[model samples]
Target: MGTFGCCWKIFGVALAAIFLFFHDLCASEKAPNYTFMQNATAAPPISYYDYIIVGGGTAGCPLAATLSQNASVLLLERGGSPYGNPNITNLSSFGAAISDLSPTSPSQRFISQDGVINARGRVLGGGTCLNAGFYTRAASDYVRNVGWDGKLVNESYEWAEKLVAFEPPMREWQTAVRDGLLEAGVLPNNGFTYDHLYGTKVGGTIFDKQGQRHTAADLLEYANPSGLTLFLHASVHKVLFRIKGKPRPVAHGVTFRDATGAKHKAYLKNGPKNEIIISAGALGSPQLLMLSGVGPADHLKAHNISLVLDQPLVGQGMSDNPMNAVFIPSPVPVEVSLIQVVGITHFGSYIESASGENFAGGSPTTRDYGMFSPKVGQLSNVPPKQRTPEAITKAVEDMKALDDAAFRGGFILEKIMGPISRGHLELQTRNPKDNPSVTFNYFKEAEDLQRCVQGIETIEKIIESKSFSKFRYDFMSLPMLLNMTASAPVNLLPRHSNVSMSLEQYCKDTVMTIWHYHGGCQVGMVVDRDYKVLGVDALRVIDGSTFNNSPGTNPQATVMMLGRYMGVKILGERLTSDVVSN
Candidate 1:
C-alpha cells in the first residue's frame, strides 16, 4: 500500500560484536540490596510505618533508600523485582520487555488515546528498567524553574551517580551519529558529561562496560538495611485518609493487595510529617490520586468514588515530548548501542540515536521471538495478529526483506524539549493495576507542530552530512518519503507522487514516543514546591508526575536525582522537628 508500510514488525540486528572499551566496575551480579518480597504476606495484616512509599520505580527505590537513613520506611511496588531479568539487564535485547505485552512482564504496554502505543515500567527500577538507560541531568534553567536548591541538587545527583550512572562505551553507529550531529551545525562537541548543554554531547548511561544495566533499584544498596522494608508485587488499592474534623483530609495510610489478592493495611505513625507518598509515576500518580477520591468532583462522581478534596488539577497539564525519527539502513553491519550521545538545540529540542536493538527482547528463556520493530507511526494501531489480510502478506514480505538488513541499520530520533501542548489522564476503571486512559495531544499546539518540523529538518541535515553519508541509507527526502509533499521543488522534494502532504501533516501522521512523558499532579497545581500535595496534609507525590515541563533529553536521571534530593530535604526537616522537641 504505502512505502515500507508493512515494515512495522520487522526486527533489529543483534550485536554482531561488542567493543570492550570500558573498565569493568561491575561486581558479580547486582540483585535487590534491601529486604524485599513478592508480597507483604510475611508482615502483620495491619502494620504502622513512619513513611509508606507506593512505588519502587525510578524515584521510589531511591526515595525509600534515602528516607530510611533514619526514619522507618515501607516501600510498596505494584510490580515484581527487576533482579535476574535478562531482558532488562542486557543492552542488546533492548526492546524485549516493552514488546512482551504479557501481564507478568516488567514493562506494561498501554496504547494512549492518541493511538500511540507506549509502555510503562512494572518493575522495581521503574522507567530506568524499561528505558534505553540514557542518563543526563536537566538544564540549569530547569532546576531554577523547579525551585530546587541548586547545591543540594548537585549533591543529590552525585550521590546517585556514584551508584548507578555510567559513561557508555560509544561504538560505530553512535559515534557516526554524534559526528553527524556536529556536522549539521549542532556545534560545540561538549564531550562526555551529564550536564544538559546546547550542543552535541555524550551523556551517561546505566548500562556499564559489561553491557549489564544498573537500574535505580541498585541505588537501594545505600539504604539502611534495618530501617527499610520493600515489598514487590504489592499493588496499591488506594491511599487511606482521615477526613473528619480537619481543614483538609490528611493521608494516614494506604490499602494494598498482595499478588494473591489478599488486602493489607499499612498506617503512618501519628505526626504531621509522617505520611503516604505516591511515587507511582506520571500516569500512575494522577490515576492514584483520583482512585483515592482526591480529584475533580464531577469526574469522581462518574466512577462513584466519593471525592476527598475538589483539587481539580490532579490530572491536568499532562505533557509528553512528541518524538519523530528517521531509520537509515547501512551497507555495513552496525554495532549495538543505546542512547550515548545527544544534541540539545537552542530552540528546545533534543536529538539522539541507537542501533542494533534486538526488538521485542522476548523472555529471557525465549530468545527466538526477538524482532526489531520499525517504529512506523501509522502502525501504532496495528498488532501483529490483527493486521489486515493485505497488510499481513505485505508485512511477511517486508520482514523477509528486512531480515537481510536488520543489523545494518539504526534510528536517529528527535523530540521537542518542553512541549507547550498538554493532555490529561482519567480512569477507565477503578482497578489499580489497570492503566488509565490518557491523551498526550501531541502537536495540539501549532508551535509544537512547528518544532517538529524544525527537528525533522535538522534530522535531514544529519542524514545528508558527510559523517553520516557512509552509514545512512537513502530512504528519500523525508517529506517525499512520508509523501508529505504537494508540488516537489525539483531539487529537495522531487516530483515523486502528487500526495497532498504538508510537513506538518507528516509530523502528525508519523509521531511516536520517546517515553519522556511528564506532568499530571504537577507542582503548584497538585503539589507544593517541596513536592507535598497542595491542600492536603501528609501526602506528597514525588515522581515525574510533578514536572510541568519534562527536563533534559531523557527524564530518568533527573527523576532519580529528585528522589535523592527530596529525601535529604525531608530528612533535614525531620531532624529539625526532633531537635525542637528535645
Candidate 2:
C-alpha cells in the first residue's frame, strides 16, 4: 500500500476509537448540554447582572467560575469548541498543532512575531490547550515586591492552586535533562526557585493525566452554571463606562462587533451595578483599552481615538520575555507513558475532587514540574562550585561599586532569575489587525548584557556535563552574531532580539528578548495594587500585562493564579458592597 493509504487507515482507526470511547462515556455519565453556537443573538437583558468578563482565556475561565458562585455572570470568548480541534484534544500528537494549518506546505510553517518563536493558541482553552503543558508557579519574592497586601497574593495563590489543579506529572517522564545540567555544574546551590521551595534536579514532565488539555472552556463546561452565559466568537471592541463626575464611574457594558461588522451593545439590564473585566491577552487587552480611549492621551490622539481617561500607564509598562529555544538532540528515543507521572490528574476528576490538600497549595506533584531556577538534584552531573567566602565578599564589593539602576537590575537577578538579560516591549502600531510591533530591546542594559553572556555560558556548561556521558548527544554551537563576513556559517541569531557574546564582544553584540514581556502597565504605572486600570472605573486588567515584574518563569501558571486571585477580589468586594447596601 502507498504511504498515504497506510497513514489514512491508521488515522481512521484512531478516530474511530476516540469516538467510541467518548460515546461509551456519554452513555454512562451525563455530559453537559453545551451546544456550540456561532453568531447567536443576544439573550434577553432581564436586569443588572453581577459580572461581565471579556476575553475568556487562562484567567477568564476561573474568574467566570468564581463569580458564578453567587451572582449571574457572562463570559465572552472569541473562539469556539475545542472538542475535535486536531491541535487541542490529542496529547501525544500535540506537536502536530505546532505545524502550519496547511498540510503539505513546508513553506507555511509556524512563524513567530518578528521571527521570535513562541506558542499561542486560538481555541477555547487559549494557550493552555496548545502549549507544551509545562506547569510551574511564579517566584514568591517577585510576588511580594508588587507592593500589594500580602493577603492578596496569599489568597490568590491558594485559590489559583485549587481552580487549575496545578500538579506535576509522573517521575518517569522527567528524563535526564536535570542530571545532565547538574553533572555540568551549570546549576549552583544558592539559586532559589520559589518561596521556601528549593530547586532540585527532578526529571519528569507534568501533564494533564487525561491525555488531553483542560482549558477555560472545559472548566466552564464542567461548572455548567445556568446563571453564567458563554458567548463564543464574540470579539469585544470597547468597554463603555460612565465617567461624568461620579464617585466611581460605573462600567455599563461592552460594545462588540462580529466578523460581519455588525456591532451590538451588551448592557446590564438593571441599574449600574454590573462591572466589566478585561482579561484579554497582554496585547489584545491593552489594544482594546486604547481603542476605548483609556490609554495615553498623546498616543490616542495619534490614532484618532478620543481620550476617555488620560491613564498614562495604560500601555506604558509593556514587557515580555524574549524566549530562546535550545534544541537538545536526544541520544535515544524518549520513552512515552501515561501513568500520571507527576502530581497532575484527569481534568474533570481533578476539578471535582477537592480536599484539604487542594487548599494548602496547588503543587501536589513536583515530579516533572518545570524548574525556574537550576536545581542541584536535577543537575546530577555538574560539579560543586559553591561561591567561596572570598568570592562572596568580592562580589558584594563589586555590587557596591555599581550604579543604583544597575545594582537594582543585578539585585533583581540575584533574587529572581539569578543572571539574565533584560528587554522591553514596544507598541508596533494602532492597527489592531497588524500584530503589535514588539521590539524587545533585548541586551539593552549593560548589566543585562553581562547576564546574557553568563547565562549562555551556564547553558553550554550544562550540555557538556558528565551526566550525558551515557547518551551521545549532538551539541548545536551558537554562531558568532557580531558583524561578520559572508563566508561565515548561516546565523540563526537573526530571530533573536538578543544574542550571546564572548567576554570580549560583550559591548558590541545585541541579543534578542527571551519573549518574556512583563512590567508594562506595572502596578504604579498602569493601575493600583488591585489591578484596576488607573483612572477607569468598573474596568480592570488581570493578565500578563499587569505584571509588576517578570515572574522569571514560563508565566502561564502564574497568569492563571493572578486571574483567579483578581477575580476573587473583584467579586468579593462587589458582593460585600451589595450586601451592605441591601
Best by lDDT: 1
TM-score of each: 0.88, 0.68
**Top TM-score prediction, candidate number:** 1
lDDT of 2 by residue, 1-582 (tens): 232222221121121111111111101012235642234245332324567787777778777767777667777776555555443345323222332334211111121233332323444556555443444555566666765456776666555445344344422223333454445343333222223223332211124445444444555653436667777656677777777877755667887655455666677655334577788766667777777777778877877887787767665555444322122223343333221111111110000000011111112232111111011011211223654446434433433332221100000011113123333333455544334444344444455445444544443444455653333224323332121111111112322222343432522222223223555455667767777777766667777777755553445666766766766776678778888889
Model 1: how far is 577 from its true place, Å? 0.5
Candidate 2: Cα lDDT at 187: 32
What's the residue-level lDDT of 247 in candidate 1? 85
Per-model CA lDDT versus the true structure: 0.74, 0.44
In candidate 1, residue 514 scores what lDDT?
A: 74
Clashes of each: 6, 51
Give per-residue CA lDDT, model 1, range 1-582, as digits (tens): 232333322311111011000111112255754554445666568989899999898899889989999999999988877776665545444444543557778867677888765667888888877667788999998899778999999998999999788898978878888998999889899999999888999999887777777888888888998788888888898997889998888899899988888988999988757978999999999999999999999999999998899878889999888876656656566766677999888776788887653432222233333333222212333455765557634543444444344334666777887999999999999998999999889889988999888887788888788887777546545544334212211111113333455667666765667778888999889999888998889999999999988888888889999999999989999999999988
Q: Which stretches of candidate 2 lie over 4 Å from their true place?
A: 1-48, 100-119, 147-173, 186-198, 201-206, 221-224, 244-250, 269-273, 336-434, 473-516
Where is model 1 poorest over a 10-residue stretch in terms of lDDT? 16-25
